[model samples]
Target chain A: MSTAKISLRGVHKAFGANSVLNGIDMDIAEGTVVSLIGPSGSGKSTLLRCINLLEPIDDGEILLDGIDISLPGFDANPVRRRIGMVFQNFNLFPHMSVEDNITLSPVRTLGVNKSLARAKAVELLERFGLADKVNAFPDQLSGGQQQRVAIIRALAIEPEVLLLDEITSSLDPELVGEVLDVVRELKTSGMTLVLATHEMGFARDISDLVCVLYSGHIIEQGLPSQVFSAPQSERAQQFLERIIRAGRL
Target chain B: MGTITGRRAAYERARKRRSTVVATVSSLAVVTAIVVLVPKMPRWDRVHESFFNGERFAHSLPRLLDAFVLDIKIFAWSMPAIVVLALLVAITRNSRSAALFPLRILTIAYTDIMRGVPIILWIYLIGFGVPGLGIERPWNSPLIWGSVALVLTYASYIAEVFRAGIESVHESQRAAARSLGLSSWQTMRHVVLPQAIRRVIPPLMNDMVSLQKDVALVSLIGPIEILRQAGIDKSKFANFTPYIAAAAIFLLITIPLTRTTDWLIERERRRTTGTRIS
Candidate 1:
C-alpha cells in the first residue's frame, strides 16, 4: 500500500497578475507532522487551502494515497471529507454554540445522526479540556478556547489529514501557548498534520519536518534541526537569523 | 476643589435651563397653532349625528373590520412569498458564473422597474390589464389584485434588503466555511444566511410596519376597506368624522408595529455592542 497521505507536484496558483504558489512540490507521509513556516505573503496559507481545493490551483497534480485528486471528474467532496482544516480566525459559526459548531459539518455534510455527532462532539470537547464550554457561544469563549473548539470541530470528521492555517495568529500573546499545547498533543497522538504557522519555537518542537517557504517557493526543507540549526541555503540561514534577531526563536 | 465642584454644578444648571427653554418654546408654538386651527376645522356635529344617531356607524364598522381582516390575510400570505423570492434574487445577484449574468440582469431590471413605478400604478396595470390578456382571476376578489401588487413591489425592495444583509456578512466567514469542506449552498444556508438575517431583522420589521400602512392604498382599487368605508360614510352624511375614525383605526393597527420596530432596533443595537465588547 502507498504511504504518501498527500502529494503535490508542480502545483501553481495565480490571482490575476500575482502568482501565489509557483511550481510547488510537496509530499506528506502518513501520520507525520510537516510545518510550513514563512514570512507574510509567502503563500503558506494558500498552499494549505489549495490542498482541500478551497483555493483552486492554476496548474498541477495533487494525489491522495496515489489517487489523482486533481484529475477531472474526480469527486472533490470525498477528497474534502478526508481532509480537515482549521482557520486562523477560528471560524466557529457565531450563530451556534460550541457544541453545535463542532457537530454541524458531521450532521450536515456527512449525514451523521445528530445524537451521534453530539456524542462525538462531547467526547472531543472533553479530550480538548473544553467540556465545560459545550453550551457557550463562540463569542463567549476566549481566543484560545475558540481555537481549541475549531480543532475539535475539524477532527469530528475523523479526517486522514489536518490542515491548520496560522491557528494561533489571532490569539492574545498570553493565550498562544494554550492552543499550541493542543497541537502538541495532536502531534504526539500521530495525527497527520500540515500546519502553516509563524510560531518558530512550536514548529521546531513539534514538527517532524519543517519547510521554509519564501516568495511562493520552498527555499529549504528538512528535519527541524537541519533546517533551523544548519540550513543549507543562504536564504534559509538569513531567515532563521531574522527570526532569532526578532527574539521569536 | 470646592470651586471646581461649583463650576460643574453651574454648567449642569445652565444646560438644563437651555433645554427647558427650548422645550417650552416648541410646546407653546404647537399649542398656539392648534388653537388657531381648531375653529376653522370642519364641524363635528354632522359627524356625531352620523356615527352615533344612525346605521352608518354600524355598517361602516363591520366593513372596516372586514378590510382589516383582508389586510392581515394579504400581508400574511405575501410575506413568505416575498421572503422566498427575495432570497432567490439575492443568490442570483451574488453568483459569479457567466451563466448567471442574464438572470442577474433580469432580476436587477425587475427590481429597478418595480421600485421606480408606484405600487398603485402597478396595481392598476396588473389588475386592469392582465385580465384583458385572458388571464381570468381564480376568484373575482379585489384582495388578490391588491396582494399581487404588494408582493411584486415589496419583493423588489426586500430583495435589496436581503442582498445588503448577505453582503454585510464578513467574507472571512465564507472562506472559512469553504475550507471546512462545505459546498457553496451549504455555506450560505448554515453560515451566511443566519448571520445576515439577524443583521436585517430591524430593517425588515420597519418594512413590515410600512407595509401595514401602505395596505390602505389598496382602497384606490374599489376594495371596501376602512378608508373606502369612511369615504362612503362621508358621502352619505357629508361628515368627516368617519374618516377621522378610520385614521384612528389605522393608527391603532400601526402603533404596536412601530413599537415592535423600535424594540427590534434596540435589541440589534445591544447585540452589536455586545459582540464588539466580546
Candidate 2:
C-alpha cells in the first residue's frame, strides 16, 4: 500500500467563541494534487495553514510522513523546512532582493554554502523566467512576479509538500493567470501539492481530488470529475450552484 | 515661432534669477539693519560687555574646547551601553511569549520610571547619591556614575523608539517568516529588524542629537564640558561672553544633525514609496 505523505485526523481549531475548523481529516498521498475550495469563513486557508503549523490545531494530530508533528514543544523548523508554503499577499521580504529571498532559508537554516545557495537561487529564477528580477526587491516587482518569486523561495528549501494558501486571491484577474500557470507547471512535474484557492475553474482543472469545505467541515470530497460534476451532499451541490449562478464555475 | 518660444523661456529664466538675487540682498539688508540697530539701543554696551566681550570669548575658547573633549568621551562610552540595554528592554517589552511576561512588566515599569524622571535627577541620584550609598568600586568614579546615569535615562527613550520600530513591521511579514520555518528570533533578526531599523533611523538620529546635547549635563558632576567651562569663565571674568561661545558650539552641532534627520526621512519616504524626482 502506498502510504500517505501528509495526513490529519480530527483536527479542530477555534478563535475564542468562533470555531474555524471544527473537524478536518484527510490523507494526501504523495505526488498528487489536492485543492480545497470554499467560500469565505469556511476554513480552507486554515486547513492549509495547519499543514505547515502556522496555526496550531486546538485538538487532533497532524501527521507528516506517518509521524505526528502536532505535539507541543516539537521543533517546528524541521517539519516547516520540509513543507513549502506560499501566502496570498506574497510576503517576500521587502528589504531583500528576489535572489536573497530565495537564498536566505537555504543558506541560514540548511547550512548551504553561500556560493552554492546563490547559484541555486539564480538557477531557480532563470528556470521560472525571472532571470532579470533577481536583483530586484519585492516592492520593485509586479504582483504576479512577486508571487512567482515567493513560490521559488518556497521551492528553494526543497520541501516535500507544497501548501499554497489562496496564493492568487490577491492578484488582479490578468495577473492571476501567470501565477496559476506556475502552479499548473508544478503539478505536471509530480509535486505533492495542496492549495486553497478561489479560482474555481482552475481548481476544477488542476485538482486530482477536490475537497469542498463548508463551515469547517469537509462536506464533499472525491475525484474532481465526481465532485464538480455530481456532488452528493446538498450543501456541496448548493455551494457549487451558487458559484455557477455567480458565473464563477 | 520657435525663436519666440526660446526667447520667452530665456526671459523667464532671467526673471527667476533676478528675483533670487533680489531676495538674497533683501535678506542680508534686513539682518544688517537688525544687528546695527540692536547694538545702538540703550544699555547695549553693558549687554555687549556681559555676553559679547571679545577678550573673554577668545580666552575661554581653548578651555572650553579642552573640556569639550571630556564630553565627547562620556558620549562615546555611553552610546553602546544605552543601545544594548535599550534593545534588550524593547525586545522584552514586545515579547508575547509567556516566559517574558515578568520581564515585560519590568521593562514597562523601567521605561515609564526612567522616562518620567528627569535626566538631571538621574545625574544627581546616580552621580552623587550612588557614591554616598557606599556601593563600592564602580560607583566611586564620577565618570562611571555619570555615564551610567546617561545610559539609564536615555535607554528608556531609545527603547520606546526600538519597540515602535519592531511593532511597525506588518504582522504578515512575521507570519511569512514563521511560515518559512524560521524561528521567531531568526525571523525578527533577518526580516523584521532590517525593515524596522531602516524606518527608525531618522528618529534614532534625532534621539542621538538629544544625547549629544545632554552630554553637557555631566558637567554637574564636575566634568568641565563646554557649558561648565562657560560657568568658570563667567565667575572669573564676571561676564557671559563664554556662555555665548558655548551656545554657538551647541548650535554648530545641532543644526547639521537636524538637517541630516530631515534628509534621511525624505530619502526613506522616497525609497519605501518607490518614487523619486530626478
Highest-scoring model, DockQ: 2
Q: Tell me the whole-model lDDT of each prediction, alpha carbons only.
A: 0.84, 0.89
How accurate locally is residue B263 in candidate 2, as Cα lDDT from 0 to 100?
83
Q: Highest lDDT among the candidates is held by which one?
A: 2
**lDDT string, candidate 1, B211-265, tens digits:** 8778777778776667777788788777665666676677787788879777877
Candidate 1 has which clashing residue pairs, if any? none
Predicted candidate 2 versus true structure: per-residue lDDT over A97-156, tens digit per residue: 788899989988899998999999999888889999888878878899999999999999
> Where is the poorest 10-residue window by lDDT in model 2 chain B?
B269-278
Clashes of each: 0, 0
lDDT of 2 at B256: 86
Give the per-residue Cα lDDT of candidate 2 at B102: 90
- The TM-scores, one per candidate, come to 0.87, 0.92
**How large is the C-alpha RMSD of every model relative to the true structure?**
4.6, 3.3
lDDT of 1 at A12: 92
